[model samples]
Every structure is written in C-alpha cells, then in structure tokens.
Target chain A: MEIIKIGMADLGVAKPPSRLRTTGLGSCVGVVLYDEVHKVAGMAHVMLPESTLAKNGEPTVGKYADTAIPYLIQQMQKEGASIRHMVAKLAGGAQMFAFLGTNDMMRIGPRNVEACKLALKGAQIKIVAEDTGGNCGRTIELDSTNGVLQIRTVNQGVKEV
Target chain B: MANFTKFGDFQFDVLREIGNIGAGHAATALSKLMQKEIDMKVPQVRIIPFDEVADCVGGAENVVVTVFLRVEGDSPGNMFFILDMDSATHLLHQVTGISKTVQEWEEMEVSALHEIGNILTGSYLSSLADFTQLNLQPSVPGLAVDMAGAILSYGLYALGQTGDFALTIDTAFFEGNDQVKGNFFLIPDPDSLPILFRSLGVPFDGDY
Candidate 1:
C-alpha cells in the first residue's frame, strides 16, 4: 500500500500494492528483482563492486554487488518469491564526470554494472531489462504490482522497462 | 574505518577552522576576479550518513552545476564547488556577459566555469597548504551540470569503502546582495584524517 524507499547501500523487499524506489544513482547500480507470479519485488542500491575491497571493518551487506544481489534474493524469497520465478531489471551505474579518467575510481560505474551482471548470472536470474553505462545520474522505481521498472534522468526524461 | 563518531567538540572546531581558512582564500580570489565584495558564512563540519549527504545541497535529484577536483599528495580528498541554476546563470553573466537563460550549457560556458573552478579551488588548496604546511595538490577541474546526487557521489568511493558515514567540511559564500551563492565542500579520504589533524596540532583519539 505504500512505497518502500531504499537509501544508498541499503535494500528492501515488498509485496503487492507496495513499490520499491531508490533515487539519485550515479556510478552506483540499482538492481531490482521481481516475481510477477508472487507480486513481490526487492531492490538494492549498490555502491561498490566487491565486498573484499573494503579496507576497514565489515561493510553493510547491501553496499557491494557481490553481497547485495544474493541478499536481495534471500529477502524476496522470504516474501514468497522464488528465484526460479524472479526476473531482474537494472538501472544506474553512470559515469558522472568524464574527465576523471586517471583515477582507477573512474571505472567504478562500468565495474559496478559488470559485477551486477556477474552476480545475477551466478543466481541464474535473467536480466529482462537494463538501462546502464552512461554519463548521467538516474532515479529508479520498481512496481511490484506488474513487475515494471521505471527510470528517470535529467536529460532523457522517463522510461519504463 | 575512522572512529570519527568518537570525535569531541574540539575536533569539530578544528575542522571548522580548516574549512574557514580554505574557503576564505577562495572567496578573496573570487572577489578580486569580479571586483566586488563577497561575504562567507561560517564553515560547518559534519559527519553524516550517505543518504543525507545529498540533502545538504537541496536533494539527490536536484539539478546542479558542479566543479570537481581530486586533492592528492600528503592529504588526499575530494573538492567540490557547487552552484544552483540561479548562481550558475549569475556567474556566467558576471564573468562573460553571456546572459542567456542557462537551460543547457554551451561549450564556452563550460570552459569558463571550469576555469573559474580551477582558479578558486587552486587558491583554496594553496591557502590550506600554507596553514597546515602540508604538500597538497589538486587535479585538473572537471565541470558538470547534472543531478546533485550523481555528482556528489562520485566523490564518495574512497570514504564509502571504510564506512557508511562521511565527514565533510562545508562552507557557503554569497556574492553581491546574495544573488550568486555557492558552496565549497572538502571531503577528505578516511586515511587522511589523522594526517590532517596531526598537522594542525590537534590530538586525534587514537584509541577511538
């Protein structure tokens, strides 16, 4: 009945009548997993590629692609969504600054996308749609009722996948 | 990760003073460029969660103009000069006399803004180096007109690795009747915190 908002390095799951949303994704991937049969959806705003890259203490499970995808799957399954019935849609992971090429961090956007794809493949979840890898920021929302992902950008307007 | 959460009032005050010196030099440079007087607000030093970082600049999706620089050398961090649409328009008009509505940035406007950012951030860094007596270097400025969330997050990768929270020293300044307003943000990497404090002769709680 309400929208569940996810912040940076966070994830959430919802059932019918509830939607999942994350805004202002730049060089960060927004991964959505949905089960149309169960009307369930889960989303994560992933900031980095791997959890192993963390130099300090343990990071949150939702912050890295290696951990977030599996965690999202497990959360959705608790809501009656099965991995077999679930499909994935992705948005975000855009390089906001083009001239920051010297730093290895500049490759983070594409690396995030690559890592997400690898994680989804490991789970055998087919990516039904994607809007990724550009020089812009995106806000994405997933509708649990019909398994649609809507992406919005500053210059490109809005599109539903 | 840094135990910045354990910081005391004195630590925050020291950070505030750091922002003050850096932004003060930048403001003086800006005043000279425009030949007008400018006033700066007191700097604010905050340690906030990532989700709330964008709220400091309007919001995540708010359209903004930003000039970004990567500070390297003894103290590594990210530097951002953010301006709203009105401020960007006002700036372009003052510097170049191109008074067109700033819906989309032309090549010339982008170049002018980039140069301004280079000059201001250059001065900002040089003055900080003078104060702390540390060797600080800034990368070439990169200009972008985009959503604030997207632009600002680009500066977060280093800090995001260690923890969910970010420490930023921010200063806002006004130009001539407060029509043109901009903010200067210095987000030092987690590893650089101790180096910064040691240079300023402030005691960092090593146990924390």
Candidate 2:
C-alpha cells in the first residue's frame, strides 16, 4: 500500500490502491472524501475551523474545513471523481483541554467538528461516518481502496469510522 | 517579607538546574527520535504569581502545550510547554519523520505530538525526582489546545485558587538546519510551592 502521512495544516489526495493517514488531532479536524466509482480518496487535516482566522487573506485550501473541503472536491473532480459517488468520513476534534470549560469561544474541538459538519452539509456531501468529541486526542487512517476510516485514541482502542 | 529582595531567585536557580537536566534528557530522546544531532540550551527559569502569568509569557498569541502530571496522591497539576505555531509544527514533523507539506491535524498526528510532550515532561519530572529525591510520578499526559491563553486558562481552572504561583522555564532546541523554542510552565499550589522551592535549596523567609 502506498501510504501517505498528512501533517497538521496539510492535505493529500490518492487514487485507488493508495492510503492516506493523519495523526494527533486534538481540536484539529480530519476530513476524508472517497469516490466509490473512481476509487479515488482525498484527506485534509485542518488546523483551524475557518480560514478567516488565518493571519493573511491569502486563502489556503487545506488549512480550514470551509476551504479545504471544497478544494478537495475540486481536486478530486479534476481526477475524474464524481460528486454524487463521493462519501465523507470525518474524525478528530477531540476536547484535549477539558479544564478550559465547555464553552463555545474557547472550545476549539467542538467548534472544529461543528465547522466540518457544516462545511460537508453545505457541500451536499453525506457524512457516512464520524468519530468525534471526548477529552482524548486521536489518530485517523483512511483507506482509499475500501473507503474505511479508522480512528485511534489514547487508552481508547482503534475503532472504525 | 525579605523586602521582596531577589523574590524567587534561589527557586529560579534550582529550577533552571533542574530544567537543564530535564532538557538534556529530552534533547537526547528527541535526537534519537528525529535521527539527527539536536542542540539544547539550559532553560531560563522564573517564578511568577498566578495573576501575572499572561503578562510574563506575552499573552495568548504564542502557542503553548499544557501537560498535566499527577503529584502527591491523586492531585494532578500542570506543566506547560509553550512555543510558536510554526515551531510546534516543525518540531512535530521532525519527531514523526512526516513531511511538512502533508499536514493533517488528525488524531494520530496529535497523539504523535502528545507522545513528544509525554517524553519531554516525563524526563523533566524524572530529573526533578532524582534531584529532590521526591517520588513525584506524572500521569499519562493529556493534550491541551496550543495557545498560551487557552493553556493558562485551563491550568487555572484545573488548579483553581490553589495554583498561586507558576514556575516557568524557557529553552531552545536546535537540529541541524531547524530550531524550535519553547517554555515549560509549572503551576503548583501554595502548599506545594514551598516543598518545590525547598527541594531546590531555596531559602524560605517565613513570608506569605
């Protein structure tokens, strides 16, 4: 398997027979898009919820969910991926800092998950599976061949998304 | 109150020594993990009152990684590893051997970063234990958001009023062409403060 590791604030795309993975998702969001027909997969690890929070207005396609998702879809389309056949799997957005209180402004994890959900919804993509919330951080893996999303959290064994 | 003379100089000195030892071990661990020679400097230590922590650290824009270690019997306090976002990402990439362009802030990635935090904090506390002969055991480290204000707020919330003082140390890590800078914030209760200071050979002046 050609495995590609994605780091924070990075994005990756793969066709059939390729695998994409990202680790350490505390308050950060991971988005996986799979096109069943074309057998192509794309994943993005977004650091912030929105690109507006970015220092400059330059706009990074994979740095935020709002921008990254659309960008991923476009890239996949260029690769002959069909929108109707694409399935979405989301992970991460763990509340690594519970002591900060469960409030909106300070809770980046919940906000990240919310933003991802909203972005996918706006893009008309159905969220086939999701693994989110809680106090522990997570690591996620996406298999482009079978569209399997796997999530692993500390002390909490790996589970399929 | 000793005229507030040299405030916590002695305490700071001892903490710096402890930071040196801890950072040494951390550098070794990091070097092995990154498969490169890492240069580390002795950390600069400071003791700041809780209310003034934000000012001392230059507020929230700076990235910070908060680590919680359990001391005494079941009371887990905090240790913060503060840094800039670019440096944090750079260090993370180096430690994991993952390229920077493939950035994906996923759970495993965060866990990988947490693993580094765990190793660094573990080494730090181990050095403290060896020096002070105190059996202070750290808990399984948990990850907090990477912002100074968020980390400080979380630490304050966890320790409450008991967290009267913070022991901070600034250090730098260099690996060939890449370098990263960071600080460790130790938030301990008043009762524990004296114990920590005394462990570091700081003379107490019988002043609150």
Candidate 3:
C-alpha cells in the first residue's frame, strides 16, 4: 500500500499492493504500462513527443514519449515483468489553452497523445484505455493491484478506467 | 540551465523591475474593475527547475483557477494568471454579483473570471510593450480550473525544449484583508531572452 509519486518529466515502477501516481498533467501525457501476470506497473510523465526535439542540453529520457516508453519497458523487464504480459493505459495530454494559433507547439496536447500512442504501438504494447485531448488538466493514478487507471480533473469529476 | 543559475543580483534586480512595472499596471486595472484597492508585492524573479514551478502557487495537486496566454510577436513567451478557488469566487461575487449554487452555473462563473483575467493581463502586457518598446501581443486567454501544477506546466512548454530550468518573473497581489489574492507569472522563451534585453538596450553577452 505504498503510493510512489512521479514528478514532472519522471518515471517509476511499482509492484502489487502499491500504486504509481503523477500529478498535474497539462499538455503532458501520463503513460502507464502494466504486466497483469506479474502485477507490475510503470508510470511516466512525458513532457514532449520526441527526443530529437531536445536541444542545448541532455534531455531527460523520461521527458519524451519516444524515449520514456522504451525506458519504462526496460525498467519493467528488470523487475522481472515480461513484455508479452504488458498492456498500456494512458491519461492526461490536455490543451490548457485554445485558439492560440495553428502552431504545432500550441497543439501539444494532441501531439503528446499521438506521440505516446505511436511509441506504445512501436513497442507492440496494446493500449487498453485512454483519456485525453481536453482543455482541462488531469492527475492520474495507476493501481497496480487491479490495473485501474484513475483520472481526476477539475469541473469534471473523477473516473476510473 | 547552468547559464541562468549564474545570473547576478543585478540581473535579477532588472527582471524584478520589469515585473513591477507590468504588474503595477495590472493592479490598476483590477482595482478599477472591482472598485477596491489592490496592493501588489514587489515582484520576484527567479530561475527555477521545471519540477518546482507549481510550488509557487501551491503543490501540484492544489486545485486552482488559471488564465493562460501565449505572448507572440517580437519576443515570444508564456503568461499565466492564477487564483485559488476561494479568491476566484470572491472576485466573481464582487464583479458579477453571482453566487454559486448549481452545477450548471459553473460555466457562467468561469466566463466571468476569464474576462477579468483578460483585462488584467492585457494591461500587464501593454505596459511591458510600451516600456520595452517591443511589439508584444497576447493570444486569446484560456481558462481552466485544475491542479496548480497541471495548469502552470503549460507555461513551461517553451522552456522544456532547450533546458530543465525556467526563468520566472512572478508577482503576487491582494485586496482587502487577502479576500482576493492571485499570482501572475511571465516566462519568456529561451531564445527570446536576447531579443528582450536587446530591445531594452541592455548589454548582453550570452550570460544571464
């Protein structure tokens, strides 16, 4: 019953009877990978879509979807969780502002969601559930014991997927 | 990231002056709207890590109202106006004379708050534009009620592309025994720094 907290541009893994949580996902995506058979879960707070977009510094591997997905899987494998039993669930990736412009950066929410999906698909991981692309912010929690992804937002109530 | 860490006290003092002028105008606008005296603190300018941005208002899970705008033009950047739930409600009551009772009433309340944000931030931007002689335009304001971390992170999108740190120019304001309190944050894009300082005729040597 320990709940591990993941900060922005960070990732972590947890076992059964434990949960993985990340808060304040806005224009960012929270991707959860779970191995049902092994009861292992991993969560990542991805700030951007691609690693190539990083410049002037060493980008945090957990900060981009293309890198974070693979890194999370690697960590899960080290925990003895097999890829064959892994399924993905996603939340967050919301557009906190609107009508700014058609600039790709302005549509970061959809871009993050699309990027996460592409990365997950590239890894051959099936996405079982998702909540994305709204104008509000979300905080997500992954319950490893039951593989339930809980999403909370303001105005809208909490929901479990 | 390390570059900003090297900012001297003089540099920070300069940024603080920018915030003071900008927020001072915003305070004037807010006072006119609410017909109440508004007092703004001396602005604080800092270069902070991305993970700590939301801590200025509260923790990541702290629910609050936010109005965000993208600063586009000569010096592109991000801007945010934030308020806690209680302060938001107080402002709504004072401005629109509406009391929240029904769930459906939330939309109207949010709209009213959005206009207030638009007006205040508009004034803040205009004064900055005038003082710096830079062509700055604010995009349409977007409103959301959510965890402070989530809403504030949107302002960091531009900063995240190049570094893990963000240079934040922030100002906090209150009115009448703290019944209404809010914060304004301005984060310029990494590349926009030189443009900003150049427009102001400040000597720039690529160091903070």
Candidate 4:
C-alpha cells in the first residue's frame, strides 16, 4: 500500500490501497474524509481555522479549515466520490502547552476543532469519529481501503477509529 | 510571514548578530549553572516553511522537551528552548542529582528541566533586550515533552495569520563531549520586525 505524506497546512486525495498520513499535529487539526464505496479519501492538515485570518496576499486553501474542507470535498468529487457518501474522521486538535492562559490564540487547538466542525456542518457532512482535544500531540493515518483513521500519540500507543 | 527574502544580506547579518549575542549569553548562563564549559554554534537566521521548521532539530515526529514562552512588548513574538530527551535527562541529572536511568520522566524531573529552560531562555531574551534596548518580556515558560512538530507549532500561531512561511533565528548549543544539546528558536511577530530594527537604529525595507 502506498502511503502519501501530507505536510502541515497541506492537503491531498488518494484511492484504495493508498493511505494518507500527517505527522505531529499539535494545535493543528487533521481532517479526513473517506468514501468506502469508491475507496477514495482526502486528508488536510489544517493549521488554522479561517481563511479570513490570513494576512498574506494569497492564502493557501489547505491551510485553514474554512477553505480546506470545501476544497477537499471538491477534490473527492473529482475522484468519483459523492459528497453525501463521504464520512469524516477527525484527529489532532490538541493544546500542546497547558499554562498558556486564556488568550484566544492560546486556545487554538479547541478553536481549530470548532472551526472544522462548523465547516463540515456547512457541507452537510457527518463526522463519524474523532480523537481531539487534551494536551498531547498526535500523528494520524487514514487508510482508504477500510476508511479507518489510525491515531498515534507519544504516550498513548495507537488506536483506530 | 515576514519575508526574510526581502531582508538583504546585511540585514540578515544583523539578525544573525542579534541571535549571537542572545545565544551567547544563554550559553554562558548554562555554563555557570553546570560549572562546565558549553559551546554554542553561530546563530542562523532564515525564513522557512512551516513544514520544515521542525527539521532543524530533527524530524517532525522526533520527540523532544521544549520550553515555550510568548515574547511581549516592543517586539512581540514567540521563543522556544528545545532539547532532545537524552539531553534533558542528562541536564537534570547534572543539575538536580536526578537519576537518568529512568525511561519515563517523573514529575520532579520534568520540573527541574522546566526551571533550566526558564533560566536559559530568560537570559537569552534579557540579553537581547539589553543589546537592542527593546522592551522584550517573556511570558511564563510552558514545558512539554512531545514531538518536535507539535512543540514547535505553538510558536507559529502569530505567523500563521500572515503566511505559511516563518522567519526563525536559530541557535544551537552543546556541552563538552556532546552530553547535552539544545536549540533556541525565536520567531518575532511580523509587525515587530520593523519595530525591532528601528530600536536598533537599523533601517528595514518592508515595502517589497
């Protein structure tokens, strides 16, 4: 099976027998959508919540949940997968530091989780499983063949969703 | 987000000098604490993508012990002191008489490492502030033993709003025989670049 690596603020789509993976998700969230019928999957390593937060002239779509989710859905459709049939599995929105206080940016992990949920809701996509929040960093892999998301953490070995 | 590409060679050299003074002070502080000679590599100033930021110390999945602090005041930004697990343990053993044989880090061991990071990073920033005459204050240091990517990403939030690229001033230090090694990464907020340069009487071209 081919393992496609997705970097931070990046996204990709793959078919059956190919897996999508992202490493070291701290405050960032990893959103994965899979269609068992077509064996198609798309993964995005979202660094922030909204594109409106961007101060750059041109912001990359895969960098934020607001842009990444819709873009990933479109890419999946291009791969012959129906949006309605795609199920989402989320992982890796974590507060890596615990004593950073209540600053909005300090709470980025939870905010990222909320943003991804709102975006997924707008697309009418249902989230089947998630492993998010807390103060640990996670590395996740989504297998297109079985629509399973494997979550790995430093202290907590590995679990499947 | 702040484009180091726009910074001319002279500007980069200035920044490198800034890192040098800061890390040099920090290395001295470490040596004083351990009573052992510590050497620091010349600081590097570069603009890098978020994906490659963790590669300086190791890979993204490489587990490390990091102390993170939010830099506030004239040149607001983020600062981090990162050490590999082995080095963290060694420093702890040398400083606190803690046993390094244990695989898992106990509470006291973690606390000892946190204090070391706090002192080292504090001296680094304080020396920079003194040199630049910029009112730079560091928030309470938060310690974490986790993947390098996860630990380092916390420093990127300020830059995330501007772009995927981050301008970093990195300094690496090691003890004799390579018993302990750690990295210092300082990422100033985009707007703070001009303020920092102005404080140093250096003219910065931001209209690229």
Per-model TM-score versus the true fold: 0.97, 0.51, 0.94, 0.98
List per-prediction Cα lDDT, in the order shown.
Answer: 0.90, 0.66, 0.88, 0.90
Model 2: lDDT of residue B118? 81
Model 4 deviation from the true structure expressed as Cα RMSD, one decimal place: 1.2
Number of the candidate with higher TM-score, 3 or 4:
4
Q: Tens-digit lDDT track for model 4 on A1-161?
A: 89999999999999988999999999999999998888889999999999999886878899899999999999999999998788998998899888874888889999999999999999999999999998999999999899999999999989999
Q: Summing lDDT over every window of 10 consecutive residues in candidate 4 chain B, give the lowest-scoring window.
A: B99-108
Q: What proportion of the true contacts does each candidate reproduce?
A: 0.85, 0.06, 0.71, 0.80
Q: Mind giving the per-residue lDDT tens digits that candidate 2 earns over A84-145?
A: 99889888676666655444544777877888889989989999998877765667888888
Please identify which of the two predictions, 1 or 2, would achieve the higher DockQ against the true structure: 1
Return the interface RMSD of model 3.
1.5
| B1-208: candidate 1 lDDT, tens digit per residue | 5576668899889899999999999999988877778899999898898888889999999999899999999989999999998998888888788886567678888888889989999999999999999999998888878889888998889988888889999999999698789999999988888889999899886522
Output the worst ten-in-a-row residue range by lDDT, candidate 1 chain B: B96-105
CAPRI docking class of candidate 1: high
Candidate 2 residue-wise lDDT at A32:
93
TM-score of chain A of 3: 0.97
Residue B185 lDDT in candidate 2: 56
Give DockQ for candidates 1 onward, in order.
Answer: 0.83, 0.04, 0.69, 0.80
Per-candidate iRMS values, in order, are 1.1, 13.5, 1.5, 1.2
Report the C-alpha lDDT of model 4 over B143-191, residue by residue, as the tens digit. 9888999889988887888877888999999999898999999988888
Candidate 3 ranges with C-alpha deviation above 4 Å = B101-108
Task: Write model 1 residue lDDT over A57-102, tens digit each, in one string.
Answer: 8778999999999999999898899999999998988888877765
